[model samples]
Target chain A: MTLEAGTTLPTQTFVVRRADLVRYAGASGDLNPIHWSDRVAMAVGLPGVIAHGMYTLALAARAVATWTDDAEVLELGAKFTAPVVVPDDDTGVSVEVAGEVASVEDGRATLRLTVTSEGQKVLGMPKAVVRA
Target chain B: MPVDASLVGRTYPPTRPYPVSEAKVRELAATTGADWDGGPVPPTFPILLAFEAMNAFLEAEGVELARIVHGDQKFRYERPLRVGDVLTAALTVASVRSIGGNDVIGTTSEVRDADGALVCATSATLVHRGGAA
Candidate 1:
């Protein structure tokens, strides 16, 4: 696939339930209670149990992998601009990821990503560079 | 308590070598709703090592896990991680500042292979919420 500049990749949405966070906590070894315990989250001034920022960022990487057929990622980064407050319901919340190829040069494609939860941007300057 | 600004530039000891296994990669990929077919591991997989290094840094500094929130993260890779690559992470305090009663601490962790070759360099910004005094 020729990812030319200004190319828009297909948008992908991923559900982030509490169970997923628990699994992510175990998988990533981040065992921080703020991701699972609502009481601790509130005591720490959070809205409630929040998803791990790396978990959300992982979803973003999953999207990129789908777009590039799992191309080797040269760089990936983002800022946690907002919390993805996950509810106790089974449905949980959804995080939407959209990307546009900003440039394609030097055998690498730079993708500018927009990641959101509940219609609010959750990552500041989320971006990735992958082998084209 | 605010994180000491003097902690900047401090480098923590490298973590013990962590063996990368296919099952571990599959576990991490499964959490993100992806099936690992034994291909390249997920880009964010190195967080396993980085978080370990960060936890040691926080523990030695007496920082509470609940009071800290992730603020930012970045990863630059020398190569994609493969199964059987035993790795270690050494963390360095990159920067520290206060904002709205929160200590925003910047840290960089170098993930290296068994040969001590850098595989990926990941950076994180942790926001520590100040407790009620």
Candidate 2:
């Protein structure tokens, strides 16, 4: 596939639930209570138990990998603009990721990504460069 | 106290090598909901090493894990990390700032192969609430 600038990759959304966070915490060894305990998260001034930033980042990573058909030599970056609050319900928050090729050069393609949850952007300055 | 700005630019010694095995990567994949066929690499997988390095950095700086909020994360790779490649990580504080009684610290972790070749660099920002309150 020839990726040119302004090519919009198919968008994807990922669900982040409490159970998913538990698995991520166990796998990533990031046992921060804000990801699991509502009381702690509230005490810390968050809306509620929130998803881990890395988890959200991973979702974006998946999008980039899917677009390029490879994950190697991919540079991914994002600033946490807001937390994706996961309520205690079975219907967890859905994170939407949309990417477009901003540029292609030297056999590399740079993708600009927008990540949103609940109609609010959660990741700022999101960008991914893949050696497609 | 605010994270000492002087800490910026100080790189810790490389940690002992960690063997990356298929089982370990698979375990991480199962946890993160990713399937592993061992092609290319998972973009966020290098964070496994970076997270370990961050732990050592927090310990050495006397920072409490419970007080931290990850604010940002970035990964730049020289190559894909494959199974069986033992790796080490060294962290360097990149910046520090204080806001509303919170200490925002920027850190960069360098992941190197057993031969000391750079494999990837993960940068992160950690916000510590009431650290200077």
Candidate 3:
């Protein structure tokens, strides 16, 4: 079954955890206090430690990878307009992705992915280019 | 508050080459939940290359690092990045402005392969969280 352009994939849910957030901070060398320090993040006006925008963007990329059998996920990008504040209560943040195949040709496809949390778009205007 | 708008249109030299390793890409993939064995680098992987160039340019300008927060980032690609791809990234200060106790800086970066073919173009916005409103 070949994935065609404009084909929308089912939404998958993911829990965004503080521990994962910390790992991302370390991996990306973006040790923003707001990503791990609940107290500091709160002091800075966030409800709690928020997941980095890139983390959410990564989830969108994951969807493309899964859809394309781990094909090259080229040029995924977005604007971080809002912070995803993860509360300390242990109910990790949830992200859902709905992807549309924008174009397909010669074993390569472009997917327009929309990632959301609590009904709000997390990775705004996300897109990916995948091979096969 | 004043922004050094003269910095706009200034193109910094290409940054030092960063060897793209599978291990680093795997780690980033795991962190972002992208497939580690995607056979090619994950999307957003170019950010590291672009950010490094941005960092050097900012340091050369004496910009206070501690005061800046990443606001937004976007990337467009001509093709996917693969292992063994040696690339050079250059940054240009696109715009700067003072906004409510912060300095909003915009920058653009172009990444090219060893063959001088454009691989990716990235744009970013950072908010310098200093100064009084």
Highest TM-score scorer: 1
The runs of at least 3 residues in candidate 2 whose Cα sits more than 4 Å from the true structure, single-residue gaps closed, are B131-133
lDDT, residue A102, candidate 1: 100
User: How does chain B of model 1 score on TM-score?
Assistant: 0.97
lDDT of 1 by residue, A26-128 (tens): 9899999999999989888889999999999999999999999889999999999999999999999999999999999999999999999999999999999
Of models 1 and 3, which has the larger TM-score?
1
2 against 3, candidate with superior DockQ: 2
Overall lDDT per candidate, in order of appearance:
0.94, 0.85, 0.77
What is the fnat value (0 to 1) for candidate 3?
0.61
Interface RMSD, in order shown: 0.5, 1.5, 2.3
TM per model? 0.98, 0.94, 0.83
Model 2 lDDT, residue B110, Cα: 92
Cα error, candidate 1, residue B62 (Å) = 0.5
Give per-residue CA lDDT, model 3, range B30-130, as digits (tens). 88665576476777778788778867876787765444567878887887787878888999989998877677889999988888898899888887766
Q: Return the candidate ranking by DockQ, descending.
A: 1, 2, 3
Clashing pairs for model 2 are none
**Cα lDDT, model 3, residue A19:** 79
Instruction: Give the winner by lDDT.
Output: 1
Model 1: residues with Cα > 4 Å off, grouped in runs? none
Candidate 1 residue-wise lDDT, B1-133, digit = tens: 6478999999999999999999999999999999899988999999999999999999999898888899999999999999999999999999999988889999999999999999999999999899772
- Candidate 3, residues A21-125, lDDT tens digits: the string is 988978876776888888776665567788877778777777766777666554667777667877666777888888888899887687888778888886657
